[model samples]
Target: MESSAQLVIFAGLAIGLIYGAVGLLSGFCLMSSMRGWLAEGDGRLVRTYALAVAVAIAASQILAGGGTVDLGKSIYLQPTFSAPVLFLGGLLFGYGMVLSNGCGSRALVLLGRGNLRSFVVVIVLGIAAQMTLKGLIAPARIALVQVSQATANSNSLPSLLATLGLGETVSRTLAAAAIVVALMLFAFAHAGFRRSPGQIAAGIIVGLLVAGGWFVTGYLGADDFNPVPVTSLTFIAPIADALQYAMLSTGLTPNFGIATVAGVFAGSLTTALASGRFKLEGYSSPRHMLRSGSGAALMGIGGVMAFGCSIGQGLTGLSTLALASFVAVAGILLGTAAGLRGALRVQPLAVA
Candidate 1:
């Protein structure tokens, strides 16, 4: 049994490394997709992002139907719900992403491209994430969690459909098919978008990566004696945890997410160096530094409040079809829009 568990852990590490490598290489980013669509009139990235979400939903639901993993075990689709936190957190995170000129995932990708600004954003985001997750701000997070008073049983749409008299298998299949078809249709509807092979492949691979994380942690990492936390790619808390782990690795066993985070930076650095993209850069002005720092802090607090960052709740949590994830995604979209053009607009500044 111990050997079997070790095998599973190895499998998870491999999967996470692959995900990190692919994400760093391809520049797959939800924040960028939405921002491109809204700000630049380039719909390809957003369409690709939507397709990835659809793929994640379909693949994850199929896994659940096959009894390969239990989606309900993850936190995003908790039995209890928190509408306020999800929406509010999304709002803050969305604006922060724009203010910082990228989302958490984007920050990682840019960090790989040898952008010092992204490094700063990520460090601040990680620390703020720690504060909300288990640091000084944890009490406030717990208090907010307590106040929301929302509830749900299953995380997927199938679970909700099951309560309406649909059989589990049938509900899961139908729900998954619907989302998948809608996303595909949306993606292919645009002639320009369909022509972008890089974006399309990025969408598919990244979506698979999200589902892969689920399979690794939920299925492979399951152990009776030494259980692993059910999680997928989420940058905010993981970054914070990664920072802490660096200081206390002796006391902490490495987990799937941490390994993946490390792999992304290493993978990106290697790619950058090999491609001659490596360069040391810093903020050109104190104002720029301040904006980046505050944006990172907002992302940390908001990501914790909402329970996941773009990759975490948006992709991983969505894979489970959790209602909370859906709500949170909606909030992220709204927040991103607000940051871009809403009353509380956060203008994008150039990274130096």
Candidate 2:
């Protein structure tokens, strides 16, 4: 059992590294995609992100259907519903990502590019995330969770389909196929989108990474004595956890999400150094720095409330087909739109 556990840890780390590298290379960022669609009228990046969501949903469902994993065990599919918190959290996180000019994952990648501004944003985000997760704001979050709890089934669409009288296998298969087909059609329909290999590959690989995370924790990390939390990619809390781990390594064992977050910074650094993309860039003015820091702080608090950041809820949570995730995603979209329009127009910082 000890050896098996060790193997599982190693596998999880490997998956994290691959995810980091792929994410860095492909520039997979939900905030950037939304901003591009809203500000520039370029929908390719958004389409790629949508494609990844669809793929993640199909693949994760297939894993659950095969009995290799149980999607219900994940946090996103918690039986207790908190609609208000999820929506509000999503809005905060989405708006913050716009102000910061990137989401958590994007910050990691930018950190590698030697962007000192992103480093500040990431550090603030991590610290704030920790505060919301288990620090000063924890009690408030706990109270909210308690107040808004609801009893409901926490299964994927396919599982719901089974509940509705469809055969389990057929329902799972059909649901997965339908989503995959729809996503593919959307991604490939446009000539320009099809030609952008970077965007397309990012969608596919990131989708696979979400499934890989599930396999790591849900399958490999399942131990009788010390089972790991069934989770996948999410930047907010993990960044906080990573900070905590650095300070209290003796008290906490390394988890998959923290390890993955660390891997992203490392991977991006490696890629940047090798490609000569590394540079020391910081905020041009104090006001700009303040804006970035405030954005990061909002993301941390919001991510905690929403239960995820872009990759967390957008890809990982949605892959499970939880109704809450859908709500959160919708909130994120709405928030991003608001940020990109009207008085919320914040100047975007140049990529470092």
Candidate 3:
């Protein structure tokens, strides 16, 4: 492998380890946030998530400002985005997340803790994602994307602001800073959240890791001869790629995404073992497995259609202030609400 590829993989591994450790330590799942906020009236976890988003946006924009990374060249910043696909994909992903009781990242964390059920979810999700990305459904997906694209404008917050007569740099700074500061105020306002060290660490560490991912792929991984795609800690395609690489590493070379995926599992497993949190778990019943499998399938398909998962659109994409990111996040929020407390809710099983 090339030395730069090695550096990129190492960077990915470091980011993944930090993310896995923090996620495991803090119970950082969006499913928990929805459940906590709606069912249990708990705001701590939700607030922590908000803090993570805010921090990610601030740090990532700083990197962009310093010329460390060109955030505009990212896939998230595409000029034309298919609104229909993004909404549908986010809805499916969010609902599936609730059904499986975790997102892709959470599944990796759970699998690391010896959860066999998560193993099942991971496989199903990966295959489903791979199929959506480049299988039988690709034609239909392409057709829909081509038809429903909202094209013409810049499709970014700063660009839109510039259209309104603001300087590009000034607009980006104001847009990013205002959002981050508002989120920080809301996140820190809660006395309970302020007192929890674990929650604080998770929010800060995960946020930085998102920005760190941008740094790894956009800066460290940049190559003139063998250019790597500029991206960050997105799980959908990467999960599928990791699975494929596991079976075909002889020919296929390791990249940041696959390395990050592997690193998350390893880091989570190490933490689980060291902390004695590892435990064997499985499906509650055939019906439970059915629900989880179905959800996993939906997540794989939807994540591809929408071009991102919860973390992808919710935190990482949003950090760039992309309009499509907000739209996707709204769809995810709506879908999560449906699964958690709306008409489409999957009833929870009884706790033994």
Candidate 4:
């Protein structure tokens, strides 16, 4: 590996460590937030999520605007995308999140605390993701994406605004400001959220980490001879890749995602041990295990189909202001809503 790629891998480790620590401390998770707000009538965590989104948008756009990172290089900004596939995938992922009681990132954090249930989730999810990406499911996913993909001259919000005769800088500025302001207002409007400084800091830190990932790949990893992929903090494909690397260490070179995955587990374990929170846990019943396994499979497939998961599309992809990211996120929110309310809602498991 080139020196730059090695540096990027190490950077990924650092970023993942910070994320794991912060996530454990603050319990920053989209599924938890949705369940809290929709099922339990608590909105403070959702507000914290909103703040994170706002900060991510602000920081990412600023980096793009300053030419530090080319947001266009990211996969989310592809000129042609399948809205139907993305939406459907998001729905699957969101519903699966509820079934598993968390998303991929959350499962990783929980596993660090010695949650055996999360170990099942992580393994199943990784296998499923790999299947979707390269195994039996890959052909179907590729065909679906190909059949439904739509091409556009402007694939992103800012670019669309520019096509409407706005200057590039002005369009980016206006779109980012509008969205950021709206999210910030929603986040800060709640008195409960405002009173929780820890939640506030978690949001800010997580958002900055997203931007940091972009910088690591786009700037520090830039090379003429050996260029690293331009990506941020995404979990779906990375988890699958991590699993593959673990089994085939001699043949495969370690990348940012693999290093990050390892870092997250290590970081979370350290934090858990330090805080006396480490405990071995498993499913309450066979039925519970089955449900979690199913959810993990769905998350793997859906995340691959949609091109991301909650943290992937919701925070990292959206930070680039990609139009497809919006559609995917809307689908995720709707799916979460479906799981949290209405006839399709998943009932809480009975306590034994």
TM-score of each: 0.93, 0.93, 0.98, 0.99
Per-residue lDDT tens digits for candidate 1, residues 2-30, read: 66456555665565556556666556777
User: What TM value does model 1 have?
Assistant: 0.93
Candidate 2 lDDT at 157 equals 68
| For every candidate, C-alpha RMSD to the true structure in Å | 2.1, 2.2, 1.1, 0.7
Residues 75-172, model 4: lDDT tens digits = 99998999999999999999999899999999999999999999999999999999999999999999999899989888989999999899999999
Per TM-score, the best of the predicted structures is 4
Q: Which ranges in model 1 have alpha carbons more than 4 Å from their true place?
A: 1-13, 153-155, 350-352
In terms of TM-score, which candidate is stronger, 1 or 3?
A: 3
**Model 3 CA deviation exceeding 4 Å by range:** none
What overall lDDT goes with each candidate model?
A: 0.79, 0.82, 0.89, 0.93
Model 4 bad stretches (over 4 Å): none
Candidate that would win on lDDT: 4
Better of 1 and 4 by lDDT: 4
